[model samples]
Target: MMTFIESVQQALQYDFILKALLVGSLIAVSASVLGLFLVLKKYSMIGDGLAHVSFATVAIALWMSASPLLVSIPIVILASFFILKLSEKASMHGDAAISLVSSFSIAMAVLIASMARGFNVDLMSYLFGSILVISNFDVVISAVLSLVVIVTVIFFYHDLFAVTYDEEYAQAVGMNTKFYNYLLAVLTSITIALGIRIVGTMLISSLIVFPTVTALQVSRGFRTTILIATLISVICVILGVLFSFAYNLPTGAVIVLMNAIAFGLAFLAKLLRR
Candidate 1:
């Protein structure tokens, strides 16, 4: 155990590990904050939806030798809007809309890879995540976007809460419910895209869902839930980074497993309190 702690300490001294930890912390906080609203609103899977869209966009960007962040963010944002429109206008369920878009996007991803033949290790890194090899450009992009998400959530907290908890009430009170819904989807899209580095598209939704749901297991009040979720997410990222380094495991998967363990413990604690 001491050797493990020493190795993690050694890993933290490196620049890349520090960058990964910084980016992971930012993403975790933003994801947890936004996720509380989304989970309450029953849109928890939107991250998964946007992750699928990002997969397609990343494939195209890699095939074109373009910046993945530049390409993925815009395309995923558009897909989020599309999902929102489908849910609102087409009389479709939100989950159904997400499923349709995500399924199509994943298909497009495979098709793009098949036709363009850009199935390299770089592509795999984006799919499964490789924070250890994340570039300086990716670090900058992730940091900026994660901060944008955190700031946006802070600025629009009440409006977002209104829309999430009771959209009809918000609309009846003369709030622009439509705009808030679109804004939520947009922020979620950005969060999902940014998470590609820390957790990968395949598992990024867990970053949002696990923390929020785990918080729900223990907290009854909305504010308390958010605080607990954010705490859980931040701790998970820190521990995940350290353990992944000490054991040479995949950081993304380890972080997810850490969240699962947190959720399990939260559930047990809830039972004990009963």
Candidate 2:
């Protein structure tokens, strides 16, 4: 059996593992950044809902023999718009709107899975993630999308902060609240789609939720919170990948467990301070 250091060196020798690290780290940073605003706006579950939508889109794409990432991006973006419109125009509220769409998407995914010859390995991989199976194309797509998300967030940071902390006040001051809302939804859709490749549909939202909450236990300012969350996310992803490689464990599950441990430690630190 290889020692821990030897196992990491061996894993790094593979291109796929390197790609996983690059893409996973990018996704973690983007997710954590977006998650801060989402959690503040009481829209954190939007990630979960969009993730289910991505699952359905992936299933549909597979059924048609198309690229899942390519097909899922547009559909998930549209679904994000639909969720926002449903909440604002239909008076459904955010969580209720998310739940409505999430349940429907899960049903569609199940229906598609059943209609196929059977539950295929591809579908299983998407549901639980097969990070080691990530290809060059996956790496490229993840990099491009993650870059777009992070850059867009930075470009509109102040607007997002205004809308997140006080949408009514933002609107009262003549800010385009609706446009920022849509921007957030669209960015989140892209993040969810990209993240599914690493963490899968079932666990992707954890990447969005955990780091922000953990950071909140210690950080007081918004900027500081995002900084802490991004650092925590990157560290967790690196450790998770290395540990999973060493133990031959599931990458996505290990990552989420590591995040959970981080959260527990953060909570303990908070309690100790008080």
Full-model lDDT, candidate 2: 0.94
RMSD of 2: 1.2
> What TM-score does candidate 2 reach?
0.98
lDDT of 1 by residue, 83-103 (tens): 988998999999999999999
Candidate lDDT values, in order: 0.90, 0.94
Q: What's the C-alpha lDDT at position 141 in model 1?
A: 86
Per-residue lDDT of model 2, residues 1-274, tens digit only = 4599999999999888899999999999999999999999989999999999999999999999999999999999999999999998997998999999999999999999999945477898999987878889989999998999999999999999999999999999999999999999999999999999878999999999999999999998999999999999999998899899999999999999999999999999999999
Best candidate according to lDDT? 2
Q: What is the TM-score of each candidate against the true structure?
A: 0.98, 0.98
Each prediction's RMSD over C-alphas, in Å, is 1.0, 1.2
